[model samples]
Target chain A: MKIKLCLQKSTPRKYLFHFIADDRAWIDLLLSKVALIFVSIIILAALYHLAADAGRMNHDRQLDLIAQDFCSAINSAGKSSYETAGGNIYFFDAYNKYGNFGSGINASVSGEYVSVSFEENGRRYGSVKPLMYKTLPLSEDEVRGELMGAFSANGNISQPIPAFYGYTAVTEFLAALGTKEENLNTSMEVHIEKTLIYIHNLNGTEVKELEYILVHQ
Target chain B: MSTSLFISDEKAFMEPHNDIISTAMIVIGFVIFAAILSKTYLTYDDNSLSLENYRQAALIANDVVGYPAIQGSRQDLISAYALDSITMPAADREMHSDFFQRFSSNADFFVDVRTDDGSHAWIIDRYEASSHDGDIIAASVPVVIELGNNARCVPGTVTVRLRKNKWI
Candidate 1:
């Protein structure tokens, strides 16, 4: 009985240390799918934001066209042009001109919410009441103050000028613009590249006061 | 060396390792997918400055032309601005201290009115802006003013130019 010198173990400790590279649990698969869905959503959201930006840019361009036309029309307003009104409907002329602002888009005159002060007899930043002169021949400064008072609104009122000037086309477009409804969402703007004062008093003498020259000429 | 040693008796195992192939496929696939998706999605840049100033210029021009000069005393001509009154005969104290108040703004603006013929005519009925060096700001609208008396209303095409200051 010089029996068994070579013996082998049925289970080896080293084998337990071997890792199966291809094996994956079900939870791993589920997590991967969830992650994929989240990533997909993020990508799609980014794409959507890009598209919305383009749409917004295009809309603004269209508005610019309509607004420019409106400006021209308003600036050229004559004595009879019913600008800022199409038979009393506000922004009517503009609405009709651009084929009703290209469907679903409405042309409107929107106002701003401003915390304003009403003092100095409505000659400062008060309610834009009419600059009524019970007496004639007021000081130029007084008159200027009266008008500037209205222009001194808290927000920009330039947006409505082009439409008002374009649509009404009044003879004196500036002179015709009175009343709250007319001035709403609009402001009186003056850019003085040059100023001319004509003395037609006794002699037809024209005097001009030239301010600083513009860079662009 | 013996021939048996150089040439194996068993068939040569030519198939690639499945684990290695699978791992490579997953990594490459994920990379390709991510690249394509990113290319398709990410695209947003700022482009509001130019157009915005353009609109601002338009508003400023409108303000200059449409500013109300007088108040309630004359309803027949209550809310009239100097630009509009310029079309009429020269009046006394037409625009006073309020000139500074009305035109004062954070953004500097320049405005001028000229006839189509390029002669700075219409001295009696014109308002000119003071400056013109800014980005994307300037609006020139064509206007026709009826000068003289109603019996002799002369039609004139005037160009009103408005510009924002460069500093603004």
Candidate 2:
């Protein structure tokens, strides 16, 4: 009975082995191809994210440098204007220096700070530096009109306003004497002026005051 | 029979064991990559911060050297008389307050002016020993010191040291 069982099992086992051997190669190849594709996709996705993060970091560093440079320029111009007979004019080319990489770039000086901001990949990045000189606050419309008038007088209005030189109506040039614009790519003129203003004292006497005026041209 | 049973059991155990080992290897690789990336980022950040601090110190030094209040007959020239008056112990309080008013309120720094010969030296700000506890960034610029009314000018150096306070 044992010999009979062995003979019957051996015949079926040989056929089963042949059948499995025929199919196993195809199945293994298919599975390995699928796994390779999945791993490649994961690696590519990770690389893309790392590249994006590095780009963002680079943008932030550039923005910080622009802010520092603007502050240093303001300080130097203010110091020179304080001593010189006539005020100083500093030409800051934001777009050329730091705005080339990011979009919706804006620079402004409000109160005691000079700030630069931009947008990248649906995220906003900004940097600010403190100014050593004092500034007087003024309204946006007033500053815009003054800047327009100055540019017009200098024959700079013959060419169309550069894309980066102007801002939308809703955006306010909040800095009293600083420039404010969105999508900025043009150069800006910072005019530091030492002017005299008279104020009425509590005793009704006229007090002469020396004031530093910063204006965007 | 025992050998066949052991072989079948080994086949079942090896699959899950291999999977766990591969998964652990992937996790370890990711952890190492992340650690290296973070360390590189931190080092870059530290270097940039140091550069920024030095730049700030340099700006302050230049501004102090060109300040009109301390300037002599010409610009970029330090007046000996003014330095002498301001450095006096009796005038320290008023001078310190004046310097605070002159520079940005955010700046925590002091200025040092000294001749090349070490004959004269002056500290423009009220400096305390405690201020040295924090990280200090310093910058210096060449300047001309006016000794007297006879137009005797001596080369000097103006140094600005900025203190960076660490947040807890």
Candidate 3:
């Protein structure tokens, strides 16, 4: 009877050990597969981030080029205007105005694309002033469109999407030459001080005009 | 019966078991994955920092060339200071303190300005030996020409730099 009891105990114990070993092997395989899937997700995420970052950089570079072109044109025009008698300024709402002085202007330009209504002070004139400005562009619309498309495909969440991103720009222009604070509303971005201007763009980005006051009187 | 038990034991030992090798492969795969992840992060960080430096350089160059006291036409001034080109101006040494501050806030800059007759040349070089702080790399001087006493001519090159802490 004792021997029979011993055999029974031994048989069950051996089976239990084998069973545990088999289960452990299967668990290890599952764990490895899960780890592989997680790692792949991480790699994909990193790739997406890198691609997006590159795109952003490319966009910034293009914006810089546009800013440089605008600055150059405006500065050239301002120099000529300041040197002219009466400090005459030819105001153009971007497309509405084209410039030619000692430097030849290549094209005839005019349009309503540039927005402005000017108020000139009755008194002294500064050597510097607002030359031109155009509205800033925002990437919010494209981003939203893509996001909306994704949401529609997923058909998961029901939430209102924000229409636009917002941004603000603060620019300081020192009075140039003999330029002074005047009641010139040449740019909507300019503040009451007339030296510094703050521009708020509801669309995440917008190019605003920078006002320059002349240095030497 | 004992022989048969011995044979069974030998058979178990001889079975083609690759569990050890399989475990090693899995570990190696994880290690390789981690290494790539680390590399990706480092590359991204370095790229970002370098790009930031370039952008900062652009901003400083714009402001420096626009300063009134710096004098000279916009194109000429930019070419002189940022491009290391010659200038045609009578530059005073005292006038460039503001320019130096504009270059960088951490270090002193030096320039070699050479003037022959009415023509001027500026070669700007910065001490880029230190990694802990900002150092001068090289700069272009905007040259201003002037006739000194006895009808002789002299040109001065201005050095500009910024202060920086050791990054390490």
Candidate 4:
């Protein structure tokens, strides 16, 4: 009876051990798959953050261009007339002549300073100037169209898109921020003191004109 | 009996298609890896900070050139800025002070004024070179020249140089 019991114990247990050994490859495979999934998620999350940073940079770049253009127009006006209050300043120096700077801006000159502002959500965004604010009645596109027609009428279609998107401004800020695009309204303004420039104007002294540019998008 | 057990074990090992799932996972992981690599590698910088500085310099140049020189509280028309101010800076201490105040900042700023013929040149600004390498943004804008008087307008160049910051 002792010999029979020993043989039974050794031989029967072999089947159970062999079953577990056979599944080792499958267990490794399952664990490897799960690890791969976890690693992929981590890498993807990191990439998402990088892409979002790039998007914010792009938005900032756009705003920078608009601000530069507005200041440039004002500088140009300062060269000739300090009496420039009402004019097509959005296309001043052809900064936004392409109508790319979306609408919601207003510009005008009051007293001795140039005034520019942008409106979003029924709220005006700008500095506290001495004069009251009034939203411009025209959009950037409309202003551009009118200017284009005027230029074309004079047989001078020299207006060209000023290499604004040389490399296609890559911006995914709204996407990365998981924010709605319609809610963001960007506006920028610049104020430059007009200098008194006396040129060949007989005996009349002339001061540089103030220019104001506003963009709403 | 041992031979029979070994045969059954080999059959069990081959029963599941484990290799298929492993290959699929590796392929998917590799694709994702490539995508992340491309996004990181194919980056193009669009930082126009230098250009913006140039534009800013140009704007300031306009103000400097357009500034009219006068006596008796700006009521009198007199040419204050001319080729002489470059040589005799003491001629307009107040004017120079005002300009220095306008363009003062943490950055190194310089205003090199000269004629188109390169005849007269002078610098009026606040600039100090840091102890390390840095980015320098400069712009040369034409000023409205005043022909007869120092406060008049004409065409001249106002070169502006601004060293932004030290690069690490």
Q: Clash totals for all models, in order? A: 49, 2, 34, 16
Q: What share of the true interface contacts does candidate 2 keep?
A: 0.16
Give the C-alpha miss distance for residue A169 in model 3, angstroms: 26
Instruction: Estimate the Cα RMSD of every predicted model relative to the unseen true structure.
Output: 17.3, 11.8, 20.3, 16.2
The most accurate candidate by lDDT is 2
| Alpha-carbon runs more than 4 Å astray in model 1 | A1-22, A25-28, A48-57, A76-97, A100-179, A183-217, B1-107, B110-168
Model 3 lDDT per residue over B1-168, tens place: 988886776424323234545645766776686678668867975664444333333333334444454344433332333223222132433233223422222223334444534364554333324232344333434444333323332444333332222341
User: For model 1, what is the error of residue B164's alpha carbon versus the real structure, in angstroms, after optimal superposition?
Assistant: 4.6
The 10-residue segment of model 2 chain A with minimum total lDDT is A153-162
Docking class of 1: incorrect
Best by TM-score: 2
Error of model 3, residue B95, in angstroms: 9.4
Worst 10 residues of 4 chain A by lDDT: A166-175
As for TM-score, the candidate ahead, 1 or 3, is 3
Ranking by lDDT: 2, 4, 3, 1
DockQ rank, highest first? Answer: 2, 4, 1, 3
Model 2 gets an lDDT of: 0.61
Native-referenced DockQ of model 1: 0.05
The per-model lDDT (C-alpha) reads 0.33, 0.61, 0.34, 0.42
B119-152 per-residue lDDT for model 2 (tens digits): 9898766544434446888999999999988979
